[model samples]
Target: MKALQITGAGEYGIANVPQPTILDDQVLVRITLVSTCPRWDIAMLGGKDMFDQTRPPDYPLPPGFPGHEAVGVVEAAGPSVQGLRPGDRVAALEHLQGQGAYAQYMAYRERDLLKLPDTVSDRKAVSTELLKCVVLGLDQFEDVKGKSMLVAGLGPAGILAIQVARLWGARVIGIDVSPERVAAVNALGIGEAVLADSLGDRRFDLGYDCVGAAPSVQNVLDRTNEHVVIFGVLRGELIYRDRFWMNGIKLESHKARPVTERYRRLLLDVLTRPEMNTECLQTKQISFKLYAEGVETLKRQEAVKICFNPQEAF
Candidate 1:
């Protein structure tokens, strides 16, 4: 089996590694599609420990898989793995165990796999794991119905947030530095899209900052009326002024919530629904051999969501 490894800062290579062995409660997945998460993966590649600071900066991370959002077929199942068997299609939540998904095969606990519907294609199903995280972020909001919401940063997560917020009956406004992303959001018919620099004298009841920079946080605090949810991973310092303190504004930072049976089922249901509209979020699809090229494209903000097909040879 071959897997991706990060040798150093801003460096990665494909390494031939042993195939994963499953435990009694585990199953082996033959990865079909893997989705790139730019923020986390890019940071890790640059030698920044975004998740945990205590861990040493070691080269060639364990499992060495950069992608966490993946959909695959069950290649094998262990003795205790019931209800799931070989040939079953499933979405893998590999990030929960600090494992990687950018490989031909990986082992996962049976409980960590979510069976995908036949109606969902592998390309769309690749977004399942990240959609679950989007669902978790929406869960953090209070009484969104009839309220106005602003989503700063029009990446995949932000775009999904706009759609989900609209489904909740909120008047959504999407802001991004990219004109192309703004146009895409406008074309979705879910909300009003505007350039970040042109947001003048506008205010929203709730704001979600998908871009974790301090400036984004400041933009949300400057325009939102009530609360702002920080959904992106922040690596910089957050500084505020006296008005921010006096306004009684609430700031909440959110990470992907724990996946449970109920939430998993809900996410699948939402993804399968016609009105959810996930197709617009997928900007590019590439092969595992071009993984670095895809990452570079993402770094240049040329694509929103890049899915990889591991079966394709270079």
Candidate 2:
């Protein structure tokens, strides 16, 4: 079994190791494909903490340290693992700790993974892990129907947010600083969008902030008619304006939830939607050996997301 290890900043090496053993409640999955998490991969390669970028990162990121998004076929399942078995096409709907999913095989808790229907292709289902993350925020609101929702960034997460919000019956308006991203959102035809600088007196029933900066959060807090959900990595101290208080504008920070049956169902529900396809976001796919090259592409902003085929060797 080959697993990826970041020996140092900007350096990586693959080593053949014994395959992982499954526990009573775990499943050993034969990985077919794994996807890059731009932020985490960039941070690991840059030798910085993903959450605290200013801090230095530890070297040799626990083989397969950051590779969580995956689609695989279950090779074996422990006795306690019910409802999942060998030959089931699946993806880990949640992050498995130090999963080393970048390898050809990984052992993950049965509860952390979910079997996928044949209708979902590996390329499309590869994004399901992220879809679960995006749903964490959207599901926070009981209902978004007929609401005017502002998506405060047009990156991958924000784009998914726009689609989900729309699917949930909300009219969406996406905003981003980059015209390219704004144009991308507009091209999707799922929502209305405008450049951040071009935003003039635009307001929404609620705002979903995917850009975790002070300006972005403040922008939503100021313009939203009723509520706001902070889904981005909040970095700076935010000031709550008096007007926000006077208007009774509500705000909620997205919370992390452990993977569960509900999320598995949500992942399938969202992926099965014809209007919710994100296949265009997968700009590149490469053999797992080319991870360094893919990260370089991500650093250059050359791709929305890169998929890695783990079964292919050097």
Candidate 3:
């Protein structure tokens, strides 16, 4: 089996690795598509010790796989696994001890799998985890309809957040450093796009900063009026201005929240509506064999959602 491995701190390499052996209660999936996560790259670049709890205590294991968003087909099933069998297409959460969505195959506990509906495409199915995170954040606030939301960055998560916020009937404003991304979001007519640096002294009711930079987080605090949601991963200290705390603003940071069964069912139900049109979430599509290229493509600030087919080389 071919797999992309995080060999050490700040390094990644491709290798033909041993296929996973299945247990009686495990499920094996033939990976079809996967997307790169920016936080994973930041963790690798900063050294494994940078993250507090999320980083596995055992640092820098040999040839570890690092991906979480993926879609696949169930190629084999364990004896104890019920209701799922070979050829059942599924999308799954890709965070665990030894597996990553970057591999040709992954073995998972049967309980973690979410069977994809026939109405959903593989690309949209791969995005469930991403959408789930946004839904979790949005669920925290109540009755945002007709209220204003300012998403301060238009990365993959930011773009989805923009759309989801709009779907909830909130008037949305999106900001990004990339002119191309601003143009793209403007074309969608989902919200108003603004340049991050151009917001001299404006404020909004709800603001979200999806850029992981400490400065960007501070900027979100500085520019937002009342409620601020820090949705992106930040590594270092962000200094806030003295008046920042005096604004009577509620600050919410992203914490680890498991997808509850209720939310899972809600996500799948909303996804089943064929007219939802998830294609806007994707910015680039590359073959799965070009995994390294996919990783590189997402490094660009303008890239929204980069997908990999996993069956061909770059």
- TM-score winner: 2
- Tens-digit per-residue lDDT, 1-314, candidate 1: 87787777777778888988888999999988888888766667767765764452477776545678888999999999987999999987544465688778888898778898898888767877778877787778767899898899989889888888888789998899889889988887857889999988989989899888888877887888878888887647776667767888778888565688878777787778777777766688876567667778888888886877776632
Q: What are the RMSD figures for all models against the true structure? A: 2.6, 1.5, 3.6
Per-candidate local distance difference test? 0.79, 0.83, 0.72
**What stretches of model 3 exceed 4 Å from their correct place?**
8-12, 42-64, 79-83, 239-248, 273-277, 287-293
lDDT per residue as tens, model 2, 1-314 = 88888888889888777889888998989989888888888888888998988876777788877888888999999999888999999987765676667788989888777788998888888877778888889888778999998889877788789998888899888889888778876886867889887878978888899989989999888888888999988979888888889889888888888866776777788888877767867888887668888888887767878987778843
Q: Model 1, stretches more than 4 Å misplaced?
A: 51-57, 96-98, 239-248
TM-score for each predicted model, relative to the true structure: 0.89, 0.95, 0.83
When sorted by lDDT, best at the front, the candidate numbers are 2, 1, 3
Error at 167, model 2, angstroms: 0.4
Q: What is the TM-score (0 to 1) of candidate 2?
A: 0.95
The residue-by-residue lDDT of candidate 3 on 1-314, one tens digit each, is 87766656545667777888889988888878876666664455335543663554344433424567877899999999996899988887535586676677888777777888777888777877777787777766665688777787877778778877877788888898888888887887766788888877777778777876777887777777777778876756876656767766777787657776887786886578554546667667766445455556666555666766655532
The collision pairs in model 2 are none
Report residue 236 deviation for candidate 3 (angstroms): 3.7
